[model samples]
Target: MATVSEFVIERIREWGVRRVFGYPGDGIGEFDGALGKAERAGEGLEYIRPTHEEIAAFMATAHAKFTGEVGVCIATSSPGGFHLINGLYDAKMDNQPVVAIVGQQGLDSLGTFNQQESHLERTFSDVAAYVQTIVSPAQAQAVVDTAFRTAITRLQPCVIILPHDVQGQKMVEPGPEMWQSRSSAVAPSIRIAPPLEQLQAAADVINAGERVTFLVGAGANGATAEVLEAAELAGAGVITSLRGKQVVPSDVPFHTQQLGLLGSRASYQQMKDCDTLVLLGTNYPYGQFLPATGQARAVQIDLRPEQLGMRYPTEVSIWADVKATLDGLLPLLTRKEDRSWQEKVIADMAKWDDELTAQAEQTYDDGVNPRRVYQELNKRLPAGAIVTADAGTTADWYGHYIRLHDGMLGDLSGRLASMLAAMPYAEAAKFAFPDRAVVCTIGDGAFQMLGMNELITIKKYLSRWSDPTFIVLVLHNDDLTQVSWEMRTEDGNPVWSTSQDVESVDYAGWARLLGFNGITVTEDDDVAAAWDAAFAHRGVTLIDAHTSKNVPPLPPHITFEFAKNTAKALLSGDPEGFGAIKDSATSLVTEGVERVKGALRRDDRDHGDDGS
Candidate 1:
C-alpha cells in the first residue's frame, strides 16, 4: 500500500499540477518527501522553492493568470502561511485561480501554546474565497477537492490547511477515488441566452441610436469575436477597461482606447458623446467618466447577474453570456452603414496612440528612457512571452506604453501596488511554462526589496528544468524615486520623506555572485545590446540598466489638483490635512478631472464651474 507521502503525490498528479511554489518548513517535510518520491518516479511534477512565501504566492498567481488553471503553492505553519496572505489577497482581487496548501501545527499540539502555532483559518478567512483545515486523514480528500473546486469555480484564492499530524498519519481506510477529470467549474446561475423581450429591447436601443459605444471588460475574455462583430454591425465605437486592453487588438478600427486613470482621452470623450452605451461584461467603477441619465442609455450584459448593475446604472441589464447576447442582438439590430462617428473616434484613437508613441520615442541623456526600452523589448520579445511587472513607476511606464501582442501575457499586483512581485512571478512563470520566455521588469527600489534572494530560487528551478532561461530587466534609477518625488513640496522643500541615497548597489555583480550571467549598461545605446546578451544566455540572466532618479513619471491631467492640495498642505505643515490629502489625493484628482471634462463637453452654461 502507498504511504501518506505517496498518496499526496498521487493526488497532485491527479490534479495535473505540474509545479508547486513555496518555501519548505518542518511541518511540510512529509509533503516535501512525497514530492521527492514523485520526482524520482518520473511523475513530472516539480517543486519551485522561492525565498519568501509571499513571492511563492505571487508566482503561483502569475501561473494561474497566464495558464487559466489552478496554480498551487505550499507553505509551512504560522508565519509561513501568513506570508502567503499578501499575494493571495491580490489573486482574490484579480479573480485569478490559485490554491494554497499551508502546513498547520501538529494536531497533538492543538489548543496548546506551541512554536509556529497560529489561527491559520481565521488569519486567511478574509483574503481567501474558501478556507478549510484538514484535521484527520479521512478528511484530506474532501478538503482538497473543496479547495480546488472553490478556487477554480470562483476564480479566486483558496487555502487548505493541513496539520503535520494529519499529513503523517496512516489512513485506516482507502482514500476516495482519485478524480482525474480536469474541468473548470461552472459559473453559478449563468444563463447562456438572455430573455427574448430584454434581448429585443437592447437591440432596439442600439438600432435607434445614432451614435453607439461598446465598453468591454476582462469578463468578456472568451467573447472577443462577438464583441468585434457587434461593434461593426452597430457602427459603434469600442473602449476597454485596463483589464480588457489585450482582449481585443488596439489597432482595430473601431477600438477607441481604454478608460480610467491610465486611459486615453479618446475613449473617455467617445463615451460621453455616444447616444447609447453597451457595457459587455464590464464593471467599471469610475462613474464620473460614464454619462448621466437622459444623456445616453446604458445597456449591460453579463453572465453574473450580481455584477450587472453594481457600478454604473444600466437602462437594460441582460443576464446572459456576452457572446450569446451579442449573437442574438446582432441579427435583430439594423446595420448602420454611416462611418462618420466611427471615423471620428478612430481618428482620435490614432492621434492618442501617436502622441504616446512620440512621447515614448523621446530620448534623455541622463536617464534611461523606460519607454524606449519597453518599445524595443515589445518589438523583439517572442510571442507568448510572459512578462511580470513590479509596482511603482515601472508599472506606470508599462501601463502607458507597453502593447501586448496576441499570445503575450502580463501579470502585476494591482490595488495595493506592492513592490518586488516581478522576479518571483517570473520564476513561477518559468516553472509553469518552461517552453515560453519569461521576463521580469522591476524598478531599482522594487528589485532591491526582493532581488538578492530570488536568485537561489531561479538557480534551483533552472537545475530542475531540462533547459531553463529567465530574463530579468532591472530599471536601476538608484533611488526610491516615486515616494521621494511625492514627498517633495511645491516650494522645493522636503516634507515627510526618507533619504533617497540607494547605496549604489551593483545589481549585476550580485546576480553574478548568485551564479547567473549579469550585464550592466550605463548608456542608453547599450540597452539593446544588453538585452540581446541576456536573451542569448541559456540560464538566468540579469540586465541592470542604470537610469536617472530625476526622470519623474508624467503627471496625469487629473492628478494636478490633488497634487496642488497635497503640496499646499505639506507646505503649511498641516499634518492632519496632509494625511487626508495623502489618502484620497489620486482618486479625488481623477474624479475631479473627469467631472470637469464631462461638464465642459456638455456646453451647459447653468452647470457648476468646470474647475470644481
Candidate 2:
C-alpha cells in the first residue's frame, strides 16, 4: 500500500502534469513531501517554486498560453490562495486553461476556529470556472478528474481544495485498473455548424460589398491559414485583437493593424470605412468603435453561440468554427478585384506605423525615454524569449511597441494588472524551460510594490540550480509618473504631481544584497551592452535602466470633453483631484491630436499636389 504522498505522485502522473508551479509551505506538507518522493523515484516531473502565489499563477498562465496545455499551480491555504486570485482573474478574462490546487487546513479543524481556515471556495468562486473541495478519500479521484475537465472545457481557471487531514488519512486500496481507466478519459468534443440561411446571407453581404474587413480574435486560433485564404478570396484586409496579434503574421499582405485602445489609427479608419464587417472569432469589447447601426452590415462567426450578437448588433451570426465557416463560405462567394480599397487601407497603415515610430524616437533632454528603452529591448531580446510585463506604464509601452514574433512568448496581466507578477512568472518559465531565455520588464513604482519580499525565493532558486539564468529589466523612472501625468491641468500646471518626488536609489545595490547579479545603466548607448551582460550571467540578474518620467503614452483616440477637463484640472493645480480621469483623458487627447494632425497633413498633400 502506498502512502498518501505516493498516491499524490501517481495522481499527478495520471493527470499528465509535467510541471507544477508553486511555493512550499507547512499547510502543503503532504504535497511537498510527495513531490520530494516522486523526484527521488525519477518521475521526470518538476515543481517550480516562485516568490509569490500570484507569480506562480502568472507563470502558469503563460505556460498555458504558450503550450496550449492546462497549466497547473499549487498553493497553501488562505494567504496563498488569496495571492492567486489576481492571476486567476487574468486567466479567466483571457480564456486561458489553468488548474490551481490549494491546500486547506486539516479537516479536523473544519468550522472550528483555526489558523488559515478562511472559506477557500467562496474566496475563489468569482475567478474560477469551477471550485470543488475534496473532503473524503472516496471523492478525491472524481474531484480531480472533474476539475481537469472543467478547466479544459471552459477554457478558464479552476480551483481544487485539498484538505490536509484527508491528504494524510489512509484509504482503502482502489484497484490499479480503476485509476488507469480514469486517467484515460477522453476530453469532451465541441461541435459547431452554421445555419444554411445565415451562411448564404453572410456570403451575399460579402459578395455585394465593395470594401470588406475581418476582425480576428483569440477564438480564431488554429485557423490562421483558412482566415487568410478567405480574406484573399474576398480581397479584404485584416485587423486583430491584442490577444490575436500573432494569429496571423504581422507581415501578411492583408494585415492592416490591431484595433483597440492600444491599437493603430489605420485599423480604426479602415473599420469605419468598410462597407461590410465580418467578425471572425472576436468578441471585441469596444462596440463604440465598431460600425454603428445601419452603417455597415455585421456578420459574425464563432464556436460559442453566446458570443454571437452578445456585444454588438449583427445582421448574420454563424455558430461554427472560424476555419470551418471560412472554408464553407470561400467557394460560394464571388472573387472581386478591389485594388483601390486595399491600397488605401495599406497606405493608411504604413502612415500610422511610420508616424508612431517616429514620435517614439523623439529624444527628451532630461533622461532616457522609457519607450526607447523598451524599443531597444524589443530589438535586442532573443527571438524565442519569454517576456513577462508588469502593469502600469511598462505594460503600455510593451503593448504599443513590442512586436510579437513567431517564437516569442509574452504575457501581461490584462484585467488584474498587478505588480510583481513578472518576477515570479520569469522564475516559473526558467524552471519549466531551463534552456529558454526568461525575461521580465517592470516599472519602478510597481516593482517596489512586491519587490524585496520575493528576492529570497529567487535567491534560493538560483543557489540550488546549477545554470540558473533569469534576466529582469527594470524601468527605473524614480516615481509613479503615470499618476503624476494624470494630475496635470489644462494650463500645464501640476496640481497633484508633487506628492512623490523622483528619488534616485541604487537598485543594483539592492539586487546584490539579495544575492543576484545587478547592473545599473543611465546612458542610452549602454542599454544593449548592459542587457548582454545580464543575459550572460549564470544566475538571477537585474538591469536597472534609469528613464524619463515625462514621456506620455499616446493611445489612438480621445474625446474633446475629456481633454478639456484634464487640461482644466492641470491648469488649476488640482491634478491629483482629477487623477481618476487623467490617464484616459491624456491618452485620448494625445492620440486625438496626433490623428487630427495626420489627417490635416494628408488633406494638404492630396489637395496641394497634381490632380489626377
Question: Tens digit of lDDT per residue, candidate 1, span 147-247?
Answer: 77777667789998888877777754433457432332232333378878998899988988888999987667767888888888889999877667666
| TM-score for each predicted model, relative to the true structure | 0.82, 0.85
In the predicted model 1, the residue pairs found to clash are none
Total backbone clashes of model 1?
Answer: 0
lDDT of 2 by residue, 1-612 (tens): 655545655766676778878877777778777788778889836787766788788778877776677788889888898888887887887778899989899887778879988888899999998999877665666667777788877778999888887777665444465443233334664435566677789999888877888898877877888888888778888898766766776667568657765677778887788888999887788786787678788889887677898766788888787877776787778878767777777778777766566555655544566766777777766756777777667767776666766666666665455666666666666665667777788877767766655667677666544457677788886777655654542234454445655466677778999878999888777776887787778777888888766566655555575457556655565534443344334434545566677787688778895434
- lDDT scores for all predictions? 0.73, 0.73
- Per-model root-mean-square deviation over C-alphas: 7.3, 4.7
Candidate 1 lowest-lDDT run of ten: 180-189
Residue 556 accuracy (lDDT) in model 1: 35
